[model samples]
Target: MILAVVGGKGGVGKSTVAFGVAAELDAVCVDADLGMADLPERRGPDLHDVLAGRAAAVEAVDESGPVDLLPCGRTLAGARASDPRALRAALSAVEAEYGRVVVDCPAGLGRDSGAALAAADACLLVTTAERAAVADALRTRELARALDAGLVGVVVDFAEETGPLRGRFGAPATALPESEAVRRATRHGLPVGEVAPESVVAERLEEVAALVQRSTRSV
Candidate 1:
């Protein structure tokens, strides 16, 4: 299954969550965050190279899971616009190579993000407590529906809030605080389950993995 994690806002921790779930399941993360390939900085071969045919998918795989990665190969000096046809071919190669492909899509509703979602079987929508972020998420969902992709989860990360006050948002507006732990892990190039084993983020990632497993089984 190709599970893509995406958000309207940049800071919502989509890649971090991607890392977490893929790490837990021992699955590949196809880092489609092309505009800013953070996965390579933390862990990878820069998928841009793979897409460009400069490298093989196996060569780009991060081995974080037993999991491989197809890092964004497009470069800092690369074209501003992505070649959708090329990306599609690359993703087809990736999908054939891995058991699970978790794509960390670039934020917002744009061609790059659209290309990533178009390749994915489903997506995990990441959101925040902020209203604008939620609106973006909703739009993202609408886009996903239009693309006929399944939505697996809605991750609500709250890295900013603290203490008991943070608990308020947990029940209604969010899924719990995956934000804080994920932030630390992503910054350090570690998966949340690895960086903070007991964190809510880690536990949530486990749940997400199980859900993915179930979905794949059904398929």
Candidate 2:
């Protein structure tokens, strides 16, 4: 399975949902969020090398014992509009070697997100309860739908201040509480679920992961 996790805005925990879902589904996670890649917070081969023909996608992967993270390293200027063919081929190579490919797409309806989604088998829309964020997600859904991308679902992050609002699209949207565990783990260069497995946010993310996996199977 190849899934792109994207939204039209940033800081809505898009990486959290991307990595969280990969952990739950036991899939290979790629940090396509190159501009602001998070998997590299712990250090890994830079994606810049891969894009520059200096490295293979697998060479940039970090095998952290439980799962492998394909982190994007080294910041680049024109990476946002990079050709989808290269990214697709890179990811396809990894898919042949792993169980699944979970792409951590950049925020917004830009070339980076579009290229990643264009190469994905499906997409997982990440958003929060904010009215503005919801609108952005809807526009993202439209773009994904236009490209004929199979949508997994919408993950509503930071539900501590949210309602029971479903996604603008018809897909299911589940909310998780915004907890300190998430903040602490991210700041310390660790996966939130691994750092505080029993925390409220982590538990909720696990459920969200399960939902994503189930949706994948249905496809």
What lDDT is reached at residue 158 by model 1?
68
Q: TM-score for each prediction?
A: 0.83, 0.89
What TM-score should be assigned to candidate 1? 0.83
Q: What is the C-alpha lDDT profile of model 2 across 45-144, one tens digit per residue?
A: 5566676676788777778635578877645663543344578788887888885888998888887778888888789888887889988988898889
Provide the lDDT at 22 for model 1. 80
Candidate 1, 1-219: lDDT as tens digits: 777788887987777778777887777777777677766443544566665556666666666543365666556654344455476667666667766677788899988888878888877888777878877878888888788778766777764333332343222222547456766776776778888889776876788778777766654
Error of 1 at 99 (Å): 1.4
Once superposed on the true structure, which residue ranges of model 1 sit more than 4 Å away at CA?
42-45, 64-67, 79-82, 159-174, 178-180
Segments of candidate 2 deviating more than 4 angstroms? 42-44, 77-84, 161-164
Error of 1 at 118 (Å): 0.9
